[model samples]
Target: MKTVIRYPILFRAHPGRTEKPKDVLVPYLHEHDVPEISEAETHIAFRSQKYALVEYDGRLFSKVGKPGSNSAEACFGHAFEKEELRRRPWWIPTIEGDKVYIRYAGQPLDNLAYYRLYLDGGDKARETMIWPALTPDYQRHLGGPRSRNEFTFQGLVDKIRDINGVQFDAGREEHRAEAERLIVIDGSYWIETTPPAICVAHEGRMIVELSHLPNWLDHDLGRQYFPLTAKDEAIEYARRAQAITQRSEEPVRNFADWTDFRFDDNPLFAFDYEGYSLKRTTFLLGGDIARAMTGNGEIEGKIGSARARAVLSAKEGARSCGADYRTWPDASDLVHDVTDAWKMTGRKPGWTEIPPKRHEFGTMICERAAQMADSMPISVSARSTWTTSP
Candidate 1:
C-alpha cells in the first residue's frame, strides 16, 4: 500500500506534424530545431525533484530546439553514475550493455540548449542532492545574479486532486483550437512541476527507505551504506507501529545491539569495498510468523483492519514465535494491533496457531536451560558485573 504525492510541472510536448506525429523522438529540445511543441505540467511530492533547469541560447539556432519531439516513453533512460550503471539502475531495465537515456518530460524547454537530464533525481536523495550542492557557477546557471537560484522549492502537490486526466487528440484544426482554450482552464493536469528516498524492496512491498533525511547529511559512507541506513527508517517505523507506547522504543533487539563480531565477515555492511553486495541484516524475526499464521502475503489479502490485522498478527506471532515475542518490546502493538484481533475473531487467547517457541530470556545461556529443566536454583553473581565468564 502506497500513497504518492504529485504536483504540477510545465512540460514541453511535441505533437507530430499530422504526417509524422509518431516520428518525434526528441531527447533534448532546441529553438533551432525544425518546429515548436506543446506544453503540459504537474506534481508528485512526498516525490520528484520539483526543480527544473532550462538554459536557452540567445545566439543563432538557439531559435530551433525541439525538446518534446522524443515524447514517447521508449526514448529515455536514467542518469546513473558509473557505479550505478553496473547495478542496473532501479528504473532502467536495460542491462549494462543496453544504451539508453534518462526519461525526462518535466518541462517544455524546446528551442533551448541541449542537455540530457530532464527531471533528474531518480536516484532519490543522491540525485536530488546534486542540485543544492552544485558550486556557484553551475548553481547560478540561471544567468543573472538572483543570489544563485536553485530549483525553487515549490509547495507540495495533492496527487489525488491534481491529477493528469484522459489523453485525447486534437481531432480537427478548429476542434484543436477550442480544445487548447478549454484545456488551459479545465485540464486533468496542472501546469507546473516533484518520494522521499523510498524504494519498494524486491519482495514487492512498500518499504520506506528514508524519511527526515537532510540531503546535506549524505556523504560517501552514507551513500555506500544506504542499504543499511535505510534500516534506520524501517526500524523506526517498526518501533512506532509495534513498540509499547509507554516504553522507550529505542531498539532493544539483539541485532540492533550487536557490535561487529567481525567486520570483514560483512555482517555489519551492505557492500564490500570491491562493490560486492553482502547479506543485509534481517530484523523482523517474529512478524513473519504472524503473517504466516494469518495467511497474509506481500501482495495478497489478509484478515481484519489495520489494527485488527495487527492484533491477529501479533497474537499469532506471539503464539508461534514465542521465543522472540514472549516479552519482546515491540510485540505490544502486534499482539494488541497488538491486542484484540484474535479475541474479536472468537479465538481464545490461549490459542496456539503453531508450535510455540519459547524465549529463554528469563534464564541465562549455557547453564540456565539445563538448570531450569533439572529444577536447580539459578545462581546470581554476588558482584553484579556485566561480564560473562564460565
Candidate 2:
C-alpha cells in the first residue's frame, strides 16, 4: 500500500495586477524563524509573528523570519543587493514579471499562514492589494474580465478540501487487497521440496506462497537447481582426475597398433596389478585420495600404493576412450560404447561421450547429485550417500 499527499497553491496576480506573473521562489526558513502551532479544541492556534511584509519597487513582498527572530529583513532594493542576499542561502525570492510580488513561496504553508493572519486581525483589504495597481494593467495580463470567485479566500479553502479528498481516496484504493494469507514460518528463507519453494519477507512479515513473493525472486528461484554432492566435493574429484591423467602413460605407439587395438575381438585394455580395473578404481577411490591429499593443504600420508596405480590406469583408459571417439563418425555411438564399457565392468556409466574434461565432468556429477538429493529422505544416512567416500 502507498500513500501520497499533495499541497497545491495557485497565486493569481493579486487583484488589479498587469503582466503574466513569474513563479514564486521561497527560501527555506531556519528553525527559529517558524512559530510553533498550539493545539486548540476547534482550530489550531497559529500566530503571524513569524512573517513580515515590506513594500519594494511599487509592490508588496513577504518574508519569513530567520529561526530566532520574529522579524526578517526585507528582501528587496539595496538590502536585497547586499552580498548576503546574493548568496541566496535559504529562501528563493518570488518574482512575477518585472515586479517582485511575493517571497517565501517555497516554504510550506506560507500562503495558509497569510490567510490565517488576514482572518485573525491583519488588514485583509490591504494584504489583498495587487501589483501595477491599476485596472488597465490587469485587463492586459489577465485576458478577460476577472470573476468575483477567482483568487478569493473562499477559493483557497475549497482547493484545500479538494486536494485532501483526492489523497484520502487514493490511499484507500492502494491498500484494498484481493486475498490474505498468513505465514506459518517466521524466518525460513527457503524450503526443500519437489518443485522447491522459498519464503519472501516484506515489512518484517514472511510470505510463503509463490504468488505473494517479489517478481525478481520468483523468476530466479524458479530456475535454480541444487546438486546432490556439495560443490566443493565435485571440485575435489575434478582436481584428482586431472592430477592422475597428467602422470599416466602416453597413447599407443602408432596408427596400426591403435587400429588393431580397436578392432581386436579380445580387447586388451590396460590394467594395474591389483586387477580391480583402472576405471572402476578411479570412480571409487578418486574422492578419498583427493580428500587425503588436500585435507589440510598437505599430503597426510602415503596414498594406498595399489589405489594409486589403478588411478593411473583409469587415466590411460580415459585417454584411449578419447582417441577412439575421435575416429568414430557419430558421437551418439561413442556414448553408447562408453556405457557398454562400464556395463561390462558391472558398474554405472561414469564417463560421457567425449572424453570428460575434469572440471566440467565434476560439475555435471555434482549437479546430478543435487537433483537426486531433492527427492531423498532428510535422514542423515540418506544424505551421506550423496558424497560418501570410497
Candidate 3:
C-alpha cells in the first residue's frame, strides 16, 4: 500500500525579501532527483540528522536530501558518512545498490528557493536511504540557518504548529510544545500528503478515510482522498487511528532481555560451535547453561545415547542432558548406531529412550540402560570447568 505524507513548506525566509541571504537550498533539498521517502515513527529523533520522518507499518524511516537532481550517494555522503551508515543498526537499514533520482517541481530560481524537499514514492527495499526536495514552507519551519553566512535556528517550532494545525496547550512547557508539535505535526502532515484511500486496521478491518482528495501529481481527486503525502497543502490529515489499533490489541509482552541478545551471546553460536542445544540451555538448565559448562573436559561425547535418555527422563527430564555418567561402552561404534537410529526415529536418542526392539534386548540394550540409569547430574563446578578433549 502506498501512503503519501505532506507537510507545509515553511520558507526559511519569505521569498523576495532583500535583507536575508538568498534561500540557500541545503544538500537535503537540492541533491536528489527522486522524492526520497521516510517512515515517521522510525524517525522520531530525526533532528539529530537534518531529515524528515515517515512511518510505514508502525516502523519509522527518514528521508534527507536537497532540491533538484543529483546522485543519491553524493547527497547522502554530504550529510552522512560511510562509517555512520555502517554503524546504524535496526534504526537505519543499510542503503545498498545504485543511485536513484527524481525530477523536482515548484522550481523558482529567484526568491522562492526556500522550500522543504518533497518526498516522491520509490521502491524502498532497493533504495533504503533517499534525498527528496520539500516545499519552501517546510524548510522555513525546520529552523536552521539559511544561506551559509547566517544560519540560526528559528521559526521551526511555530511553523510546525501552523503547518499541522496543532493547538498549543498553555499548561505545558515550550519544549514540550515543540516536541508534541513536531511529532503530531509531522504525523498530520504525512497523513495529509499521503491520505490513504484505504486503511486496514490491525484487526483486519479496512477503512476508507477519504473518498477522494485532489492529487497534486496528476491533479485528480476523483478516486479517493488525496494521500497525506501529495504535494498538495489543502488536504492533509493525520491518520493515527491505525497506530492506536496496533497498540491496543497485543498484551505487552516484555521478553526484551532474551529477545535483544547481542552478538557475543547469540544462543545459535552455542548450538553450532559447541554442543549445547537451546532446549537444554534456556528452559532446562535455568539460563545460558552452555556458558556455565564452558571449560569441562571432553564431557560431551563421554555420555552415551542410553545414558543421555535416562538422564533426560529423570524427574528433571532433558534438563540434565549435560550430566556426567559412569561406566559407558566406547562410544565410537555406539554413537554412530545410535545417531543412525535417531535419524530414523526423528528423535534425539540422548533425549528419549524407546523400548528395545524384539531380539535387540540382549547385551547392548542392557549395558546401555545400565549406564544411563547410573548417570549423575552435572555439577555447577563441573560445568564451570567444561572442555572438549580431542
Q: Which candidate is the best by TM-score?
A: 1
Q: What are the per-residue Cα lDDT tens digits for candidate 3 across 125-239?
A: 2112211222233465678433321221132333222211221121112222112212222222222111112211112211222111111211011111222233131121112
Off by over 4 Å in 1: 1-66, 71-95, 98-390
Each prediction's TM-score versus the true structure: 0.17, 0.13, 0.15
Which lDDT values do the candidates have, in the order given?
0.23, 0.23, 0.23
- CA shift at 118, candidate 1, in angstroms? 33
Per-residue accuracy of model 2 over 251-311 as CA lDDT, tens digit each: 2111111111111111121111111111222322232232223332222223334434433
- What is the Å distance of residue 273 in model 2 from its true position? 74
Q: What TM-score should be assigned to candidate 3?
A: 0.15
lDDT of 3 at 237: 15
Cα lDDT, model 3, residue 39: 40
Model 3 bad stretches (over 4 Å): 1-96, 100-150, 153-390
**Total clashing residue pairs per candidate?**
55, 13, 79
Tens digit of per-residue lDDT, candidate 1, span 108-190? 12101111121121222221232222233553466732221222223112211222222112112212221121111111211
